[model samples]
Target: MKKLGFGCMRLPLKVKKINSSIDMTKTEEMVDYFINEGFTYFDTAYMYHDGRSERAVREALVHRHERQTFILADKMPVGMLVTKGDTSRIFRHQLKKCGVEYFDYYLLHALNAKYLERAEKLGVFEYLAKKKSEGRIKKLGFSFHDSAKVLDRILTRHPEMEFVQLQINYLDWEDEKVQSRLCYEVARKHGKDIIVMEPVKGGKLADVPEKVKELFALEHPDWSPASWAVRFCASLQGVICVLSGMSDMAQLKDNTGYMKDFEPLTQKETDILKTAAAIIKNEETVPCTSCRYCTASCPMNIAIPEYFTAYNKRLAGEDYKLYLEERAKDKGKASECIGCRKCEEVCPQHIEVVRLLKKCGEIL
Candidate 1:
């Protein structure tokens, strides 16, 4: 199988609204082009694109293509569980929504240390394993977001999980909070196959600092910034696939073109990435992956990611004042945050929502 997977989280949206529908026509074209390019892995979660990613994949990929040609991966939103029966209810709904009887790869989504404990108490692992046994799911695993110590515990406790999905990229590789490298080592230690998510760090690495750009130009001027980020993950041992949330045809084309015959980065290239990480780390603030987990239940309906993107732009010395103004229309401004902390609870990045929103309010 190819090392690249299509992540459905950042699929193009039809509108700027929080609960806006997906742009289906463009998505279908992306799906066709991806399959035609000899790439088959497509991953979606229950809450991706406001609960529409699965159905969109159903219309764009699953419904239109031969099921045997592609690999479909969907995740159980373990963070959304309120009762033990949630595992059963959501699983049945996901099967129906994706227009599939069985999933090629299924995982419990966003397993932080706290959620991992909750999943155990609620019997989520047992439920998903039974589905796998019953042929409703071909493989079962989890996407993790916590530290290495917590990860070691979960992997030790649930040895039945076939693979582990991790948020990995050159930028976050050695991040003290994210611990991408440490987590990768832990997964390898447990002998679990790895599915990499956020290889481009939610579009952060794709748009790099000028210093990093000069360094890349010195090495591989032909390569796009995204190519370097994605390749970094694919080159890692035990990484079965690197998932990129390509939002448009250009992105899809660029990703598929480079990954068609993937090459692992050499020692010198790896050293360049290490230096780039140090430069990016100093400039980064709020480290939001634009996962939009924080915006899902925002009482003020703030476009949190958009504001953060604008803030990052301003810090990067890019023009963002007008852009921020436009995004603030029909959406909650940074000043509207009530400090309820609801968004923080669901946030996988461990960002201080109230605090950051306050900062965004001041500048953006």
Candidate 2:
């Protein structure tokens, strides 16, 4: 597998929505360049691109190349499953959608505390394992978004897992909210091969604050913002590949250039990034990972992640009043909590929902 895997979640969107429309020509060029560079890992899921990602993969990568030349990773859509029989149906649909007979890599998509429980109850792994034995799937694994403790518990019981995908980047390496270090440590402790996602923190680190950019430019003026992020994940001991959701061809070229013959960040470079991450963490007011678990149980139909995002920006301490003014543009702010405790219960991190909302409301 190539050190850089193309994430299909952020493929060119027409109207900022995944299913609005796709730019086929641009995607084709990017895929051609990606494969021409000797890279062969592509990842997609059901919910990506507003449920059109699988079909786009068929149009972009799967149909264009021989199955033997590249590896295609597809994920089970547990959120779409309503019963045990639905698993086979969804799997078959995915096969038809991607126009592939078998997947090189198959995962239980977006495993968190809630989704993991749903998967276990629905016998997802059993179905995937059975398919693997039947030669329809090559390797079975999962992409995780959960706490270190939850991840540890899952790995302990399912050591048969061939590999695990995690969100690993410099920003979340030491974050209490994302707990990237602890989660990766747990995966390594269990001897699981790690597939890294969000190496650029969903593109937030790609275009960093000017101060942080200036600092990195002093040492490696030629390195792009994305290079610093990819190197951070690649520097880790057990990372197999880092996934970058490149939306344009320029990003594709920039990333592959640095990742071609991968260079691990030196101790000095790593130290610099750590200092930069620290500065950003201090500046960020709301610390949300956008996992969507809290919104799963929100009673008042509030978008918890978006609210927290605004709240964090307000607390950034620079032009906070301006941040508050911007947040007012949203129809639903944090003040609409209505004292609902549903979100708190579903939060695996046990964030003080009411308290945080109160603080956020004060800002609003």
Candidate number achieving the greatest lDDT relative to the actual structure: 1
Local distance difference test values of all predictions, in order: 0.90, 0.84
For model 2, the stretches where C-alpha displacement exceeds 4 angstroms are 16-18, 284-311, 314-364
The collision pairs in model 2 are 285-312, 286-312
**Residue 246, model 2, lDDT:** 87
Give the 10-residue window scoring lowest on summed lDDT in candidate 1.
12-21
Clashes of each: 0, 2
The TM-score values for the models, in the order shown, are 0.80, 0.80
lDDT of 2 by residue, 83-190 (tens): 999999989999999999999999998888898888999999898999999999998899998899999988888887989999888888887878999999999999
